[model samples]
Target: MGRVLLAAVAFAGVAGTGNGLMGQDVPLAADFPEVYRVGGFDAPEWAEFAVPPDVRFDAAGRLYAMEGFLGSGSVVVIDTDGTLVRAVGRPGEGPGEINRPTGFAVWRDGRLAIADMGHRAYQIFGPDGEFERFVRAGSVSDPLGGAGSMGSKLRPDPAGLSLIAQGPPSGVGALTDLFGELLGAEAPGEERVDDRGLERLDLRGEAVSREPILEGWRPSTAGAEPPELSLDDLTEPAGMLTMMMSGQRWFEPGFLWDVLPDGGIAYSDSTAYEIKVTDGAGRAIRRLSRDLHPEPVTRRIREEVRERRLRDLEEGSDLGAGFRAGSGGNEIPAGIREATTEAMRTQIEDREFHDVIPVLTALRATWDGAVWVERVGEEPWVEFGPIDVMRADGEYVGTFAPGATRMPDAFGPDGLVAFVELDELDIPSVVVRRLPVKVR
Candidate 1:
């Protein structure tokens, strides 16, 4: 049987630092188990502090990871089997280094992209951990694009995309020579263009241009201050929302993943409720929504909304006085079929996600054909869920968690997995976990 832990010696004071560039975010915990799984990690001693932003495996199953001493701002590397390897970058603005490097992804191109939110740009590094170059997204009209979440697919889904949210919205621009000339355009200027085209790189550091890889492409609107809720609803659920906001912000994203060589894309949804698939051209191929649990409270409220709308539409006696057109001049008709349809869409796609978990930190693929996701604390005292295994077609294989933290990156998409721990100041240390299964 599974355990629910809400308090323990090491589970309190769970901390995370955001860019604070987005909307006001809150992280809080409700009820959780007290004694959870903590025996699978290989390095019991080194499993204590906050880890840097990421940890990944190497071709040889060696865990090459980055750890930050939180407030110290030091980034260290570790080898497989839980031994200190090297320390390269530190927290501060300097060349060949980083400032609050919050994200890392080992691309199929063999190079790694570390997102230093303090210093915006996808900083590329060679597999050997050498600083390569930076890829400037310049300004993306939609950073998430048809893509839905920041930690979408196997990485952090980008959410709460609003000019007011992400400071000044970034524009699309090439990371031209930091010291070069341009078409009289500012070094970084805003230009709303279509997909800047796509580049697929492999572990060998080879670059291949491909199309955007999300399907059923629709832009995202998750992180924006949720549209104003009705006063009564807000008054009623205020306590629940307030409590949840303290330890987690469902819309804040921490990482991202692109489809391999624009081949195909598969990823979990915002609420971690479904896995959606898309072709290279960014079209939704399929989706698998989980029925693991049905939430009754949320369902009841939505059902009431539907019933009220139906009563008004059928009888035309009660709600006619309250129908007022919205910004589009579409009046809120008593028989609001349009309103009802939108309401249903919101209930399924957005509103019903009260207890659903958001992508906590990162998502990575195992060397043996499975995906692993790491989150802060799903239940009290529990650091992570198990290494979730699924068939590429979206089958629920299984899950195994050694501790708390995002799914640490694996060097290759093979059998091994890495996990990390962090301290109060937000610095992180690395932990390594592996599968006995042979990764072919």
Candidate 2:
């Protein structure tokens, strides 16, 4: 049995730093140690998972572990202590089958909602792992063709609705870069444009309402240099000769905002660390922030990140080569292949690092209604990074560490569920770690 913890601890006086913000900078009362761990090197005789990227806990605390990519994976259910209970659904295009399973939302009625990438739908499944029905997700025209509009995060409401972010295809320019550039054709960017924002969907998958959330085009970057290729870069023959360029608005407050339990909004913007909580009418109700500053991305930091990037590329290339050797090489045209490789190489070798990191990298609201804000550490990739826990009323709790034993993917009433991946084989197993009562 996993240890159940007090959702929050009492702390002394701490003041909010910014104007219109409610939370104070409540530092930890003591060191946050791991109280329990559920997954490890040991595997159950019944199951072996590959690349389980998403994990969720249902109302009953049964863990749902999704392994493999969106279009090809299985959802494995396990007990709180990492015992394999059953595996549900396989990769396919049929009913009950999921091609790409990206996100999960637990319905108030105790059913599971899955955001399927391949099917362009939120496939609902019963607690018994039986296929219910597909709530169809909307699609948009990408440069590659039609693409799903649902983002990865899914939040369920008590009113029989699920909240999700909707955006254009992340890689909308890929096909345009290849085909349009090769033929020197100019394409307008209008059709690919989308009103990126929060979308509310009912159980049957009908979108009840859509709220525009993102503000202006303030791009935020950290380690990677600006991408050289724009949609126009490849299409304009001259741009092919020149370096291509691209940028992404920091995913912090804009697309990263969460729908609050009370049907409100809690989102951060690019200019500040504060989160503006808004009611349904888009009126600001409260704001949340802490007295923390972003770490500067110095030259040394850039070099270290560069090394990591290069190593990752090398490993990926090796994996690609190995796959090609086994399944025969890709049948891409030589001209396009050469051009794409050179373009990626140039960008990787010359990306400029942002001087300061984003204050908040990511945030999620727990079943207990506590907002978990992932602070950007000095070393972004370090294990056991600190996460600040804030109550629904915007009171700051202590920072908790998800160390090597617990890399949490989803949080529930009992604790957090992490996909403990085996280092050597990359096989994934589920872990549930109970939260500590006090930070210490």
Candidate 3:
């Protein structure tokens, strides 16, 4: 379940149903008859952190968690038994220290690489947790100079090369407008373009090749504002109402696209439950599909899910007081207090939910050359089990049970690396369990 990296790349076309990839429509109860259950590792009560966003495992099965935020961040290294071994890195501009770690990866040579967006560099660490060297990720001044944004996912390849999933550089106008937005200035009628794709970068910080994958939505806060309304007259009230609009207004849900080990790309269109895989030449060789029905998002279902989500947020973690209670603990003035409550109520009553949920939510290409299509479970929260598996030759191999394992953040020689958030405290813990040898 880690960022599933598939093996080998082939560009041979296949006929529709005759291709044998047309998956069978089977009930979940009957599909997963035998389950491959595995136990999870829980963090010790003594170890705690403000936030842990990323989890990864090196060749020796050692688990690492990127804990804390921008300035207060540190990498917590753990043993196989979930015991806190030690912490690495901190807020600093020095060699090993990192201001903000956005993404991380384990190189083929057993080197742990962490991308620090604050410093615009990737700090390389040896297996023993020692700082090796640093590589410039990219430059903000030069949009297309190197790897691009801080959000790029780093993947390891042969010959000291890495593949990064990032968008192309912004135009001069877009950069100008973006800077204006950061400075709280209005730059109306300016166009902003975000070209989504993949880039292959050499060890010397050079983008050797680029592959166009899909077009995605830019952040709403990126210079341009949403369409104006009567409420636009008084921005505060209008702004609260407008912000509550769930989902994207301009762009569709993005596809779960990733690059295969041998340089092929495998992705699923957001609108349908079909996987379009291509080889190094970028030719469509096969389309993997399943017998799935997009579940209807009825009014009742929508309301129920919304209620559950809100309850989880209120009870789960330490969200801002503004979100938990409308009054903001009486620290706000009466005028702003009334406006906030009214805006929230209006958003709940006026918001519209989609008619149907997408059949598949994510697509991952595993190390064994199998594609795991994550289906939208009947329950609202992210579900673990019943993942659909497809073979290398575009053939459905039935669903596999995830058991106690959460969605994997990374994979290693031992097994999948998953993170489980404890209740109430919302403490993060890492678990590495070996998958059953036989796929039931």
Ranking by lDDT: 2, 3, 1
What is the alpha-carbon RMSD of candidate 2 to the true structure? 8.5
Off by over 4 Å in 2: 1-42, 68-72, 81-86, 139-146, 166-196, 203-217, 220-245, 249-255, 280-282, 315-342, 380-384, 401-407, 416-419, 437-440
How close is every model to the real structure, measured as TM-score? 0.45, 0.70, 0.67
**Candidate 3, 305-393: lDDT as tens digits:** 55764564445332344434433144555666556555554544544554567677666655545666776665534565457766646
- What is the clash count for each candidate, in the order shown? 83, 12, 1
Could you give me the TM-score of model 2 versus the true structure?
Answer: 0.70
Question: What's model 3's lDDT at 416?
Answer: 44
Instruction: Score residue 351 of candidate 1 by CA lDDT.
Output: 32
- CA displacement after TM-score superposition, residue 134 of candidate 3 (Å): 3.8
Task: Give candidate 1 regions above 4 Å deviation.
Answer: 1-53, 67-75, 108-110, 117-119, 134-263, 270-273, 286-293, 298-364, 372-388, 394-414, 422-429, 438-440
lDDT head-to-head 2 vs 3, winner: 2
lDDT of 2 by residue, 1-440 (tens): 11111112222233343332342344543233343344345655445543445666676677666654522366777665556677777878998887766666665345777777677677778867788887655323233222234545566755555554444433333433455455554553323323234445555544223444323233444553334565556554335533324343212224346666566666665435666665643455566767666666677777776677677665556224323233223464556545555555555566565556667766676656667676655476564456676765666665644442332566655554344545565555554556554320
lDDT against the true structure, per candidate, is 0.36, 0.54, 0.52
lDDT of 1 by residue, 1-440 (tens): 11111111122121122321121222222212221112122335333333244454445544434443232333344444445555445556765566655445543333455545555444566656677765433334323221111110122112211000011111111112111232222432321222212223222222211222222222243443333333233333232232223222223332233342234444443434444444543345554333332223345554554555456555643323223433225655444544444443333333322333343344544555444444434432244543343444454443444342245444343444554444455444444544444221
Candidate number achieving the greatest lDDT relative to the actual structure: 2
